[model samples]
Target: MINKRLTFCHENWSLREPFRISRGVKTCADVIHVAINCDQVTGQGESVPYARYGETTESVLDQIEEVLPEVEGGTNPEELLELLPAGAARNAVDCALWDLMARWQGRSVPELFGLEVQRELETAITIGLDTPEKMAKKARMNRRAPLLKVKLDQENILDRVRAVRIQAPESRIILDPNESWNMDILRLVDEELAGLGIDLLEQPLPAGQDDGLREYRPKVPVCADESCHTSQDLPALTGKYQYINIKLDKTGGLTEAVRLRELALGQGFGLMVGCMVATSLSMAPAILLCSGADFIDLDGPWWMAKDREDGFNIQNGIIRNISGNLWGGTEKAEAAVS
Candidate 1:
């Protein structure tokens, strides 16, 4: 076994403004950054401990520590999947290993997977949940963005969506209720949302309770977020969702995320790559999964008050560039913790 070193720490990146979703609001992004060193080469990754998944920083830290010995003994991404479940802990380590391998091979992660990295890709700009007037204002501010992801809940569903639709009539819109709506609400709003030109509806119903979607057809395409994680969950999501939102954190990292994407597409599911509110270190690895995705919602770093040097360049909802020194590149990884 190759001698290696593993280290991790918790980081809190303050958001420029509070990001509100159906569940709650977040003013800071709490994440865990992991690094693995071998033969004087370092690779790094980051993950957000999602409260919606019952993950806390402490819990994630403990999970990583428990696997420290095996990781330092030179475990690969495939082996790390068996060591940790699909969540934030495995995500960090898995991504770090991928970055390490890519560096060792003198290629970018996308190249390692036989994929070409786009110089610029259009991404969705998120407008967090708020009052109709406030939401409209936010939409107006980002009207130039190619795509706008509007956060909504059960309350004022029509009002909120209508407000955003009126502000940015030309921008492609995605309504994400974040598992806050019931079948009745979805049925009631489906036609109206379709008429309003809402492009996609994400996870209207909660996980384990969305079996009702099997019989209900909607005017708008539905994407599964909370309801789907790895490829194992794809079987259950087959008839219910038209698209699956693949987030590395939810899939345990790019390793499973790639498998999930391939399997989901084979099963006739469209793709949407997403991310929790996090730093560029987290979003950098996700870029590999965005090649043929139908919807890209990787604006996590756009919400940060400040980002790391040599991070992704996002302007007007388009990711223009990803520096080589970032997470999954051929260049050496820098210290990612703040």
Candidate 2:
């Protein structure tokens, strides 16, 4: 087998345009491509930004560059956990290795990971920053998407939710305030979200503010996004959140992500798999984590104006090519031996 070297270039995909949220957004998301080659076949992975962790595209690139020697020297994903902290750079390299190992052995990643199957996962299409009316319009346009995640800032929470609910009355909604709300708003808006048929609310308050949520309850279940990263972040979140948003970038890569999901499920925390704006290569390995996830939010690549050559497909909001079945520009399905 040809031991493939890790060589990559930065890709900047412009959002068809910038979609603002209360926090902020840009016209583009900087992505990194990580590939593993074994002479006979090559496998790839991708990753994106996580500003919450003070990570920019430049920072992520720098992290990978720091680990250049190890990755080239044939660092396995297990050893990678020590070389790099959990973030976009590590996520790409780690996932690339898993993909490479699977392809080299002539097995699907899930199969090699000892996973039963890569089932159909329903994903949530995000409605980025717009006035309440415009967001409502966006929701209306996504008629085929089974679920819609309504992005909220601290301001005008109810108006935006009301608008979106009005446009797609039959659809299920999830509200993500990106850690902008507090105990007060959470209580005030609880009734409104329930009336609008919102399924859940995610990270309404800043991570530190979660202490305030202790002993307090809201009408809808609150999920921890920024507050919960790995299993280590779970202990403090016990009484506050009923759900946890698992992201490989946050946990470093799929290696720890799977463990975190199992731990979260055992702790009675519902699961949601979310993503930053990345390519299909970035989302491919994450499909494995969605097996028991209650909500799927892998819509990062779909927002890009142009994606990588072998990215997954999002049909009517359902992730059609998530398991790498539709990759490499071929329509053939990869089946496991009976």
Error of 2 at 157 (Å): 1.3
- Per-residue alpha-carbon lDDT of model 1 for 187-291, expressed as tens digits? 999999999999999999999999999998889999999998999998899888999999999999989998998888888999999999998899988877887
What lDDT is reached at residue 93 by model 2?
A: 83
Off by over 4 Å in 1: 331-338
lDDT of model 2 at position 72? 71
lDDT (Cα) of model 2? 0.79
Instruction: Give the number of the best model, judged by TM-score.
Output: 1
Q: Write the per-residue lDDT of candidate 2 for residues 1-338, one digit (tens) a residue.
A: 44667766688778876767778877887888777676767767777767778888788888888887777777888899999887888888888787777777666767666664454567899999689888988988996788889888878888988888888887778899888787887888798778778898999899887787888777788899988878889999999899999998888888889889889999999999998887777777778788788899998878888876656678667876544542211122244511
Where in model 2 is the C-alpha error above 4 Å? Answer: 323-334
Q: Which candidate leads the pack in lDDT?
A: 1
Query: Which lDDT value does model 1 have at 300?
Result: 93
